[model samples]
Target: MPWGEFKDTVAERRIFQHRTLVALMLLFVMMGVLMARMYYLQVIQHDTYTTLSDKNRVQVQSVAPTRGLVYDRNNVLLAENRPVFNVTIVPERVADISQTLSELQAILNISEDDLDRFRGRLLEPRRPFQEIPLRYDLTEQEIASMAVHRHTLPGVEVNAELVRYYPYSELTSHALGYVGRINRDELQRIDPVNYAGTNYIGKSGIERFYEQALHGKVGYQHVETNARGRTLRVLERENPVPGEDIRLHLDIRLQKLAHDLLDGRRGAIVAIEPKTGGVLALASVPGFDANLFVTGIGVEAYRELNESLDKPLFNRALRGQYPPGSTIKPMLAIAALDSGSTNRERTVWDPGYFQLKPTGRRFRDWKRGGHGWVNLKDAVEQSCDIYFYDVGVRMGVDVMHDYLTRFGFGEETSLDISGALPGIVPSREWKRAHRNEPWYPGDSVNMSIGQGFNLATPLQLATGTAVLANRGVWNQPRLLSDVLGDHDFEEGLFGAARDDIILTDPDTWTFGIKAMEAVMHGTKGTARAAARKAPYRMAGKTGTAQVFSLAEGEEYDEEEVRIRLRDHALFIGFAPVEDPVIAVAVIVENGGSGSGTAAPVARAMFDAWLLGFPAPDEPVLVKSDPGAGE
Candidate 1:
């Protein structure tokens, strides 16, 4: 041990202390540089970093808007929202999806389709933690079973959703239309932002036409979430605007009545208010339930509807095209009177048949024997085919075509409802263009009786009858009265103003209307025997449209012909002759004589709507079941 060694150890210790101090000082300077760089990134560039941070934590979720409600004129609920329990799965939160589904299937009856749809949704690349719908309208048993296993199945949830329901399922189906799931084609057309989480859209009829009004505006919510992507609390929210309700002009009571009256009949009945043009009822028989289409319709049900021979999916009221038949008699009578072809008092000899000059082809009348000499008024009252044929030969087809076309015969009625058909009203020009043939005198005679190349829809016939009831003033038919907004606000949607129709002369319509009245009221009237002392006075015309063409000397054989091939019976009428309210048009497919079959249906509809369900004292006239006739 020496004093010099102790001194050297002391010097080394001092040198080590200086080096440690220098290293500590350098470390502090480097730490300061790092802190300054962090400040620039976190404080100066706060907005950029904040957005990046939120991207990792927060997510945007879509909320669906409440759909609108539908009501009849009397405020009877037709379409409404019903609470439905749905089963859902969150992909990111699920531990074992297959095992969880197996447990779910044990309690609920899950169809093969349900599993496939769920799996398909899972495969799509979407946002993390999105709730995929597993099954809709889960039963109570399913909910209870799921509740017991909710804690174990982390991502599974049971939610209550609003589903569309139709109270009168088939009654207002065609008129109200239906809503269905949004498909790839529909999603392209819809605004993804506006639709938000909604999956259904209006597919047809009035629902499709007024989709904007029925689909409410979407809203937003800022929700605070946990690390597991579970909602902790709603930080801020903006409630979605509820869609406006729609009130229809249709009378549900009358609609039901008409539907029942048409029971088993393969035809259409359209009744409208002559003055206002509000359709009381537009019933097409064999209607389908609209609820089946609310969600995705089942394959079997959809196939049945599309393949049915009765064409349940067809909107017969607006789209069915049929021959006007003898119903055009009133229009012919007006044309004859207006064109000076005959006077109201003019008389013609009815020899039971009419012959074309030179060709000498005898056109046989409905009556095998003669109707005897009859005047214009008497001929119309009795529905004498021979008398009309004679007048038609004189009037000519070219003239009749021009006159009938003016009455909206060849064009669509432009009804408020969709899918209206414009029936064919053939002119000399049309015959030449379409058939490549010349219009002859014999053709004119057939057109006179509404038999040759004359066609119309039920809606057109009803509108025409309404025009006659209102004395040539045509009002466009409307099924919707107004659209109702929030706070009970209403705006007139249809029937604001009526359009005047083209007619030869006002006097001619009056004469024809009076003649139609005689058909139901006069002793010789064809429809008189069938109407049988109704409570209110009715003005009507009965028509029997031929279904096929006969050979040179052939006649119709009812037994030999199939029921569907038989002539169509038609009747057009209005109630309380002087002040008409409801103009009814009824077409009974292959139903025997218009007076016997079609007029009776019109009578029943009139009595129910105008006269309040027929008094017990009033005569009960029931139409025989259409199936029995077939």
Candidate 2:
């Protein structure tokens, strides 16, 4: 042992004890701080920590309310909700959305539209962990495939949802319209919380008009979820209230009759109940199957519909604007009588045509020789153009515009019909604004007979005819008969009330109706042949509207022109004239004579409603007189 490295056992023991004491103090301090932290978390902030922890295990999910159902007057289901499976994905649980989408495409027959729609919805504002639909109406095979790969795809799910379906798709396409996926515009306008899980919305017609009533309140549930965002159990739930079911005044039997009557034709028919203003039947031919639009119509199929010449999507009853032609004659007679331009005993001699000026253009009548001598009753019965031309000119545009407006010619009058156009009733102001031209006397001459700038929809004509049937009483046309719920249908839903059209002479209504009655029963009545064997009396007026102007001394030959370019046939009438129940307006495009083509259709409709001629399942055989008169 070296002398300098001498052992010192006592001093070494003191140094070792001091180091041991310092290490113990440090460990005790660390342990005290750890205990304080544990106490703070476990006791003081227990609720906050538990809440944070439960957030991972539980989620509040939105549940969509079932859509309402639609029924006809006889309780036939028009529109309903059908349960269907859809492929869905929750983005929060998806590891790689792109990769998952690709995998889904490999397993399913997904189109570009499906991918585009999915991406669109993904970009749209949504709540956390909400399931977005990828493909709708999945087939059984697709569902099985998705089930087999469910474990591999974390966020993928097969969700069953109720989708809107129209049973009589083709029969009621225009009347009921349809539902489709909510678009960006709709999303911005809708309440985010209420429509959280809702996907479809009404697109048009009655569905769109009463959308709020049709879509019910949303509900929610607190669900226990696993690490992969899969719902394990429902902790709490609030069931949603289903929408109110609505019943319409439309009769399916009558509607089917109208459709069958107009089969193979491009035209429209609107039948209304004069007493209640309830629409009985509204039919537009060449209608499409509304089902095609419900589940996102394909691009190719939509293109075909959009480009079709027949215009199957066009709602001719409410939207189609036509010249109205001689259908307004009965209405014009009322105007002339009320304005004192002519009286019931007034007579005009027809020399085949009327000259605005002695040498100016001659407005020829449909009859070649003439209806030599005609009174108001005689003219209306015979559909004599010369008599109407005289009265129309005498009444002029101002008096005619004011009086005809009362008959519902130039405005939308339906309580629930959507997309109805206010037809053009040209006055001095209208001509100045629209045509940017002064109102010429010649314009008045043309408008006097429901030509020139006078345009009216089939619905408008029906409404006007209904007003006539009611004898100046106004019942605004409506489709909503009742709402099947505790909520009573508000009378204010029909909008502002319309005042009755009261004339100075109440007898004028009876006189006008008598003249209209003559149109059906009189020996020389143009439509008398159509009313030949009618059990009940009907008051009607037939009309022929020219498509194009004829040059001076030029004649209109039906054989020389194309079918689409021929004159439109029109008729307006009410059956059982004494207690008019049904008033109708019929238009057959390019069908030549109104008496021949359109009047018979009205007769059939009357028989269907009044007599129930053909059984519900029986086939209809309409006998049309192609060469009948105007």
Candidate 3:
């Protein structure tokens, strides 16, 4: 045997032993690394991993606030909240979203829009397992059916929600406005944290004006949930601060009366408590159902409302600007009487037409036959165009413009309601600024008659009449009688007087009232036909506002004109001339004959409101005044 061979054998054995030791060391190191990772994940980072796991199981839910209710001055509900059920979903809980949606479509006739909305919502960075709204305002049958088969559905859920409801339907549509689902624009406008759980917001009218008071604070519940993210129990809750309740100045009964008086005509009527500027009834006829807009309105329904020839969605009371027409005559006469530009005893003989002296453009009278010799009082009473034309031309546009502005024409009313239009009162400055034209005597005549660029809203007219009835105590019109909020705010913003509105000259109202009385009771009074035999004395002025430009030789033939192109019949009045209680302004669009059409409606409103005369079944024909028929 050789020694070298033995050594080689020993070397080979050593090499094999070293290789085995290295492999064992590497294996031990790998095991240690794996153990450390296991310990770290299972113990050290347990909360992070567990939260990630439970996120698949647990759910957080919101309980939306119950919207505040709206009431009329008499406590009649105008807008309210009604209970409704909705189908909801959580994306991560859904195993196969497409399959679940298909099943949901079968059970609930989900709209294509609903499915598209659901997909879009799921795409947002949201908690995957949190429930989201699928279908809103589900019927009882729908809820019951969905509940019955909900066990088979994984992520599908049913939630009880409160939806906005309008009880008056279309009666107070424009005044009360409407609420709808909050959108992206609203989201940016609204406080995200406060409106977190809110679904809808007020869009217009009083609703929008008082949105902050109506939209209650958000609430939260510390809810315990099951493995499927279903609510198991509620641990704690912070109750929501419900929104303030609002009591409007509207009288629902009177509102109904005024609405019915319109008889589905395209018109607007506003009645106010003369002393307080509290609107008893403000109605815009041919109004839409506000409830239809509470949720998301259908495109077709929206289009129909927006494109209707009658303009059902138009808020005529706040936004409609019409020429004051003959209604402006009483105010014009008041201006003349107050400014000493003309005396009530002063006489102007009407030969049925007025000529602008140097320019022989005749301003024709509504009466073909002459009103004979008429005093300033008689002129207002008869709405004699020729007599006003003469006095207005004498008073000039400057003096008349200054006086009418004091009565709120061509100005935005300080009413609490939003979106009041400040009508244009054209003056030399305004005409020059807007039209780049010089003022004319004919323009003054037109303005005196409330034509030729002059415009006024029904609210403005009512407020102005109220000021007259209140003897020039101009009260800022307020719709909310009481703000049911926690904090107390002053009656008016900017320290305005709420009561005892003082007029510089109270005697002016007396003179104006006397002239308006003549309009109802004096011989040749235009509105006498409607108010002559009233149980109570009503001092009113009838107005016929031309909607189209009539040629110099053209007589207005209502039948020849389109309904939308006809004159707007206007009337403004206060009842019991000596001690007025109610003031009103009525505008019937394209309704010819203010005395026959507009005055009668105003008479009915006065009877129902101030006189407490129950609504009459038919049009009661009172005896014509000796002054009737202009």
Candidate 4:
């Protein structure tokens, strides 16, 4: 009925036109929204989206820089870079990792250790497409096999790279140290951008101390990759900066001599040039091959090194703690003379033991019957323990500590090597802190004789001997002779002595030197018999450090004790005493007597350096010259 009422032709035509216009406007609005979205994606976010798309086919890779070279004082190559082939894989690009690994094992020898290391890396947080090394130093047969299966294996590749190598690895292991795979701890400490491509880092010694100078700048390249993430070609590259070449003060020839002299013996020898404070030789017996560490050392090989009885991994030169024994006699004699406690002419009557009071504990001397009527000179020459015991009580622990500290006893020598320990210089305060007890008169006597709470590293003994050689001039020992970079010798690139060990009366130093000289040449000198064949005059002191103390009523019998429990033989000396050149310290573990076991090693070292062995080849590495290339 309503439709019939509205059936006027003109009104109906107007209503139909208005509804059609409204529908057309709604369609146009939808088209405008769709066009706006298309424009935003095509123009505003163009670069961002393009980059994401290209990432599937392109990569930005890091190029490792060539590491610097290392040379001895004579320009002999100590550390070098050699080319090695490695088998690597990109995890993301591999289709079936388990199947691929199984196939790979069938073609080559992959030990459980190798597989374990690879699996460990897979679990680590690393870049998705980074090349993970599986086996280093791949053989020719392995390379050929990899080539035959190249097409089937999409992500596997054989990469060639330079690796760190040592020529005389065993000889330089302790001094030069060695490089090892960078662990997670080291990675977190290093700059990510700088160490993007680096895999190895210095593990110890010189290598660790100078890591900054040894690791060069990183570089980058834009690469075109395929579907399997294989590098098709390098599009653009920026070259990296090479590291600095280092020339050491160490004489490899002398290092070898020291090693040979201590053949199969557990001992340490540290020799220094007194004038320049350059370390000439640092030898620790039973050293491991440094090359074994460059690439990840095998599990068995590492186990052997870690479980060795002689402790080949231990750096005896830098960290060995032992009783200085009689080596401290000359130092104590100086303390006595300078402190007004005693003089070169002072004498003490010894009946084999010492007592601070009229009736007290008897401090037994090395001689059973005691050295009777011995003076300062005779005490040092004969290493009379009783004479030192008498004076040490009078000097007190405070005086002894002060004098020894000045000689670099309680501190590190700052020898430009890592892990050097500070030998203890015991005082009342130190005793209270460490031993949790008060200082006693007997403690003073023991300190005076370089025993009891006293401990000295081989490095410390060498440093103290250098002070005597320099005649009170405290030249800090250093291993870096020259940094083959912008450095000036006159400017003192290495370093100067911290300061001279100034004393009130400098003549006391001469008195000390004279006493040391008697120990090598005097008739009753402890080491005279050992030094009889020397062509040159040497000043030295012999000491036997007790590994285990004897009770007041007990006596030490060597045959009854274990070999490791015997005394540690020690000797400190300098050649050409009048004008000293080389100062050395030797320590033989479990050696019965210093004069017999340790002095011979020192004599042999002096003979090698002074009496002359074959010289290093021509063109000895001279500092301040920059043209020398690897």
1 or 3, greater by TM-score: 1
Candidate with the larger TM-score of 1 and 2: 2
Clashing pairs in 1: none
**Per-residue lDDT of 294-371 in model 3, one digit per residue for the tens?**
756666678989998689988899899888888878777777876778886788888888887746887888888878
Question: What would you estimate as the lDDT of candidate 2?
Answer: 0.89
lDDT of 4 by residue, 190-265 (tens): 8888878888888898888777778888999989888767789988999877667889989999998878767667
Off by over 4 Å in 1: 1-18, 48-58, 89-103, 115-132, 151-156, 436-442, 485-499, 502-504, 548-561, 614-630
After superposition, candidate 3 runs with Cα above 4 Å error? 1-60, 90-99, 112-132, 485-505, 549-561, 613-630
- Comparing 1 and 4 by TM-score, which wins? 4
Model 3 lDDT, full chain set: 0.79
- The local lDDT score (0 to 100) that residue 94 gets in candidate 4 is 91
lDDT (0 to 1) per candidate: 0.80, 0.89, 0.79, 0.84
User: For each candidate, what TM-score against the reference?
Assistant: 0.87, 0.95, 0.85, 0.88
Residues 25-63, candidate 1, lDDT per residue (tens digit)?
Answer: 999999999999999998999999887777556656667
Expressed as tens digits, the lDDT of each residue in 42-117 for candidate 2 is 9999999999988999888889999989999989999999999999998988889999999999999999988887
**Could you give me the TM-score of model 3 versus the true structure?**
0.85
Model 1 residue 629 lDDT score:
14
List candidate 4 segments past 4 Å from native.
1-50, 486-497, 549-561, 614-630
Off by over 4 Å in 2: 1-17, 123-128, 488-491, 549-561
Error of 1 at 443 (Å): 3.9
Say which candidate scores most in lDDT.
2
